[model samples]
Target: MAEALADIGMIGLAVMGSNLAQNIERNGFTVAVWNRDPGRVDEFMATVGAGKKFVGAHTPEAFVNAIARPRKIMLLVKAGDATDWTIDQIKPYLEPGDIIIDGGNALYHDTIRREKALRAEGFNFIGCGVSGGEEGALWGPSLMPGGAPDAYENLRPIWEAIAAKVDDGPCVTYIGPDGAGHFVKMVHNGIEYGDMQLIAEAYDLLKRVGHLTAPELAAVFAAWNEGVLQSFLIEITSQIFRAIDPETNQPLVELILDKAGQKGTGKWTSEAALDMGVPVPTIQAAIDARVLSSMKDERVAASQVIVGPPTSPEMPDKGDFIMLVHNALYASKICSYAQGMAMLSTASRAYNWNLNLGEISRIWKGGCIIRAQFLDKIKQAYHRRADLPNLLLDPDFNQWMADAQTSWRSVVSIGALAGVPLPAMSASLAYFDSYRTARLPQNLTQAQRDFFGSHTYERIDKPEAGFVHTEWKELIQ
Candidate 1:
């Protein structure tokens, strides 16, 4: 079986899958390719403009037979019930100990469940996250493979060379055992939501007050593409702004709805964090903003909707406001990813995943959607202290926080004044403050706790037996 079609091939021929197959082929793995529609493979061969680099299987059975021994099949298709249907289609062709990898953004819980079900038939299952979008797929993608160590070891070489490199390091690694890869990707999407929301809030500010048009805004984002603020989303956003309507010759975005669409990963990240008793305020706010944006008509009908960002708009000049928003955006994005990383850490401890955060950062460099330079810092930060609470806890990141705090407040205040929504942005700053603060005002809280449950309070200066006998004395009654 290993000799028939070579090893390390894939199924499905969507743009993402097609590009990824091409990348695998480029990286020197002989890939046996198949799509749901076998006819499309022929079309793809023509479109690829390279006959020698890629070879396609004419049918599912042919595809299954092409793979060599200790068979590994990578599934790249639409997730959920459709994925199940495809798995069923391929089942009859599989033998015991055959491997299957789901590289789509399926739910982590679903991955765990799928692995269990597949094991019943003596199959090995892996859930991996493929990132860096289409171009990355065509070249090398950040690959996060999580499941059995043997399955990961078997596929390592193909993933190793094709992933983005970080200081001579490969960007692909085993994220954890079982469902950890998908879980990390879930948190990645959540952070993406928050980062996007912050940028949008900045746009709203520049549009409403700074007097910038779409073209001008596009330029700002383009400039950001080269700076520290650069990212995949920022790059795409610049292109999106340049898109125009053929009929009206106007910016297409201007005519689109204010609402946004989401698949379920971001929502799940927030929900999972809540279930774990973790604070991910910015990510949750971003998710909420999307949900609320979708309820557009209902709010207009009510005429009772609240308006504006949470901060007041005062005590800052225009230049200060811009810098504040920018700094705040940067600081906030760090927090979002930190939360995701924290979840992975927690889940790792629980699952005995023994995931290496630095290795995870290395793997995230190129093959995935969230690939960026910041990941280098993430790798460095985690390498310095594997148990560092978050990126912000790192010395360099801490200094960044101290510098940005004043500006964040300024931007939030301005957004409130200008009637823009900075839900995610403002929330990120708040999360940072709450997370960093050693002491938060809790007298009212302590009184309530003691009143209801007799929960004792620790004195600010002391720890043992700090009673609340001065509950009224503290008020000087």
Candidate 2:
């Protein structure tokens, strides 16, 4: 007989949405859930929603009516057009000051546009990045919410209660205005791409060169997981190796297709880095590796005719080589993180987002795909220097890289000599070397550009002066 009131309302009753709603309810807040299809709402109410403090609504109007004033609604629908459609459907029911939170993998630029438009209509908008996928949603996920300060203040308690905790702090923070949350999330996904590819390269090297069995490789990864490489991905990778394919009676990973699939976050990050003139070669290389892997037919055909070098490099002692691969993976991971953070730094300045880099690293310690034991060091690095240009430049990371360089180089060299494509690892090493070099061969590149396109070059002799052009024909003649 009485209208049920909810602290928060969630649209899109998909796995992520439903799990997040349950998480909210578990945190002692009542949640009102609505889905595009009323059948889903009825089904959820009958199953997962039965015991939970959930208010199931069949329509947007009922969902809005069930929420308390200055309503907080989270949209976990598909990113692009579906997000826009959901907003349009609910806008008439929402009053001014009501907050709409988008928790999808949307492009940051799109988030910015939506925020601006929603604000113009007198509604508050938040582009919140929800990481760690379905499990994280059900338990606790890292939350990066960017929007109006007032809206964030209102949503803080709810988010803080539901987010994963590292030490004593929650893995949720107010990431600047407009699209900042999505931007950081995009960079996170990019770093994940590089991290995964680096791990894959290590596996390839150990299998091809060391000739280790799947179980042995799994042991190696399991060992790494106990050390600095400890993370969700590495833990899962070890488990993946140990799994047997029911159909093939082989390691699940071996039985699976060679082609890797992507959902575009990595590509979006690469494109954003290029547009911002930020160097993220490791991320780019990871994306390229996926694209190359997708051409399974071409690769198989090419393998027959292309004919790589005959002599495979001699493998080092198994024990020594394992350590080398470990060091290489760790060092390259540092470089990839460095590049991802540098891009974030650049985007912060370019977009005037005033992002807190230190806090970003802190929140990423849990409930994110890139969460690792080493992230603590990254947090400290930024805490030591808030204006840190790159993670590689930090004293701790710098010392680690200096110590790891020998083994890192060895791994890369072995891959090259053996014709094993270590694109991500190689690119990371190249990035490190290029970054440390005071002077590059760019002067020659500039000269060639000037010769062919009259692009004009800046002279080192006059560092503070304007660009200069030279007549190459007169000198050649």
Candidate 3:
């Protein structure tokens, strides 16, 4: 009988899986890699896996056997049924207490269900959120693992070794038990959607209002990358603008279609927020923008039929408008992240996860797509007050928002006048305003509801009194 040689095993051989396997091996762990299709295993072994510390397994039984007991296996399979199918194939061979990790973008509820089922069957399951795209997977990625504490302790060495390091610390952490990791990842992606959309709006304003060419825009983004907006997405956006299209002999972004693609993670975030009664308007607007973008045919038809503003607004000083855009983007980003943080806080309490917001923000400062210079401020804010209800209430952020409010309002107004859809930015501003307002018009809505259905509402004047119904029409009569 062959001896168990591999320290850990990975079951998928797609770009993400292959890169992660190589990363593990690079960290000095002997890794066993398998693919559902044997040919892929062969191809990877010959190419990316060649001369690496990798053991190619032909079957699920062989894959399980190659790993040392109690084995640690990660699945980078498709999120839904595919993950389940892969697990079933390996379950028969897995011994008691072996850890199986779902490293894909899974729905948190599904992760919870799987973890519970696996635990009942005398196994440990971890729903780990792996972020940082193909390149990050190959080098280092931010890892969010949620499971039993013992299970995390077992995998800690490997996770910490392969995670991106920032400020002399790893970007991997043991999130709370069960689905917390995946839930955090979902919100991360949702926040990423908002970030991308906000940056896109800023780019549009730079081009249309500021009259900056692609190269100029690229330079602007590069400059922003050195400032408060320094982030992976912003840095990439600069590089993307600098790319030239060979076929069109023009800026690549200019030649490409405006439509965007999305997986269901953003929608999941919005749906979960709705279910929890948490308002994530910026993230919701980002999802809506993507959905609207998908209707390319309808949009094309509408573009021809619907008349927009008669004239485009020209910025008196392009430099000054550019600064306004920077302020607007920064302020809007604060609102977007605040909304996501609120959702996380709500989920933490509801699920009894006891999440560490500061740690989460700290780990997100590197390797993840949403990693930003701004995250350090968030970490500090949470460290100062762990139970902060909203980031807008934080002293630093409060002052920043107050200082930038005029610029943000001007940018949104200009977009409106120019007939450009700045959904995320506008929604973020509205969310901020709505949150700050002490007295809302919802009183009138409550009165209307009571008049129609006798649904009661609380009275401000009647202290200590519960909900009361008033015949509003009778008072008018």
Candidate 4:
């Protein structure tokens, strides 16, 4: 094994894997190669790694045997159950203290479970969330790693040497404890859902109300990048809008559908929040929006799909309505992040994971899909106080929301008047206002409790609880 890979490192190359391997090799790391398909490695070396020396392994055992001493193998595969099977396949041959990183979206619990199982086998496991698209992989990524702190230290050279730089530099850190890394990535994806929904809502308003072309919308997004909205999400939205439809010469966006896809992370985040009793309204609604979108044909068949209002059905108010939508989107986005991070904070406390919210936000600043200007605020929000309940309540963020509420309200009302569902977006702002209101609709709430949990209710202005003069509660009293 030493002779086979002593000089450098090894990579398992797929399209992304190949680019990433070349990235590692380009940085002067020796990269041994393997794949489910042996042919792909040869092709990758020929094209991406041109003239690079690479070792190929025929089997998982042989692959483990081929790495150099104090053995280390980084597993880059599809996330979840598949990741576990890959680790299990390689475990028998890995020696004590050998490091294996699961660089995919395995559940944090799974990471913790895997860490325990492998450590008991005298091997160390690191669950790493490697972000940045292929580009980030080749250049550098925002790496969130969790496991034994010593194991992270052992792998720091590789992570730091291959990560993006912040003012603080190098977007890599030990996210603490067994599952913190995956947990951060989970929140990362949850916020991502809200961010995408915000963008889509923006596009929907601009297109529907302003009658803006894709190119026009793209230009607007590009300008946003120069302002408070400046971030990766806006940058890409600008580019995506500019793409021309070759046949029609119109913006390519018109050719696209109003549907989006997810690979379970968003749903998982919402589900986890519900289980923990966290009020993650924005993130949960984001998931619901996608589920509703996916039921397109069935919805149409059932006459359940409806687009309520025209862009400006009332007195040429389209522009005002559009601005309001933007405000609503922004505020709701804050709610989503707050909810997701709150969940992380809760899990961290209950599970004893001293997760760093500041570090997590900083990584999302650059690489990976969900990168947005809002993340910078989030980083600042947490940096100022690690224990902040949520980003919206962060002092500066609250100021921003206070300034933006009128616009948000206008947008929600316009959407309502115009007859757009605006359910997720409007509901997001509703969650925000509700959180801050110190009061809510509990008129039916007490009835709901009495109906099921049999809890007593209170008078409208009284602190004292009184059971309703209903059959069950009155008899029990």
Q: Give Cα-based local distance difference scores for all models.
A: 0.78, 0.94, 0.95, 0.75
Tens-digit lDDT track for model 2 on 1-477? 886699999999999999999999999999999999999999999999998899999988988999998999999999999999999988999999999999999999999999999999999999999998999999999999998989999999999999999994999999999999999999999999999999999999999988989999999999999999999899999999999988888998887788999998999999999999999999999999999999999999999999786898878899999999999999999999999999999999998999999899989999998889989888899999999999988988999999999999999999999999999999999999999999999999999999999999999889788898899888995
TM-score (C-alpha) between model 2 and the true structure:
0.98
Candidate 2 backbone clash number: 0
- Write the number of the candidate with greater TM-score, choosing between 1 and 2: 2
For residues 41-131, write the lDDT of model 4, one tens digit per residue: 5676577666665566667766666677677677777877678777777777777888888777778888899898888888888888877
What lDDT is obtained when candidate 2 is compared to the true structure? 0.94
**Models sorted by lDDT, best on top:** 3, 2, 1, 4
Report the lDDT tens digits of candidate 3 across residue range 156-216.
9999999999994999999999999999999999999999999999998888777899999
TM-score of 3: 0.98
Locate the minimum summed-lDDT window of 10 residues in model 3: 311-320
Rate residue 211 of model 1 by lDDT.
Answer: 66
TM value for model 1: 0.87
Residue 317's lDDT in candidate 4: 58
Error of 3 at 201 (Å): 0.4
lDDT by residue (1-477, candidate 1, tens digit) is 434466765888888888888877777777788888877888877787255556578877877888876778889999898779878888889899888999999888889999889988888899988777788788777778888888889888777877766665777777777888888778777777777777787788777767678898788788777877777777888898899999999999889998888888888888888877778888888888888889989968755766545664454565555566678777777877777788777777876778788777767665566666777788889989998867778987788778877877777776767676788777887788788778787767986786667675667666665574444435654
Model 1 lDDT on a 0 to 1 scale = 0.78
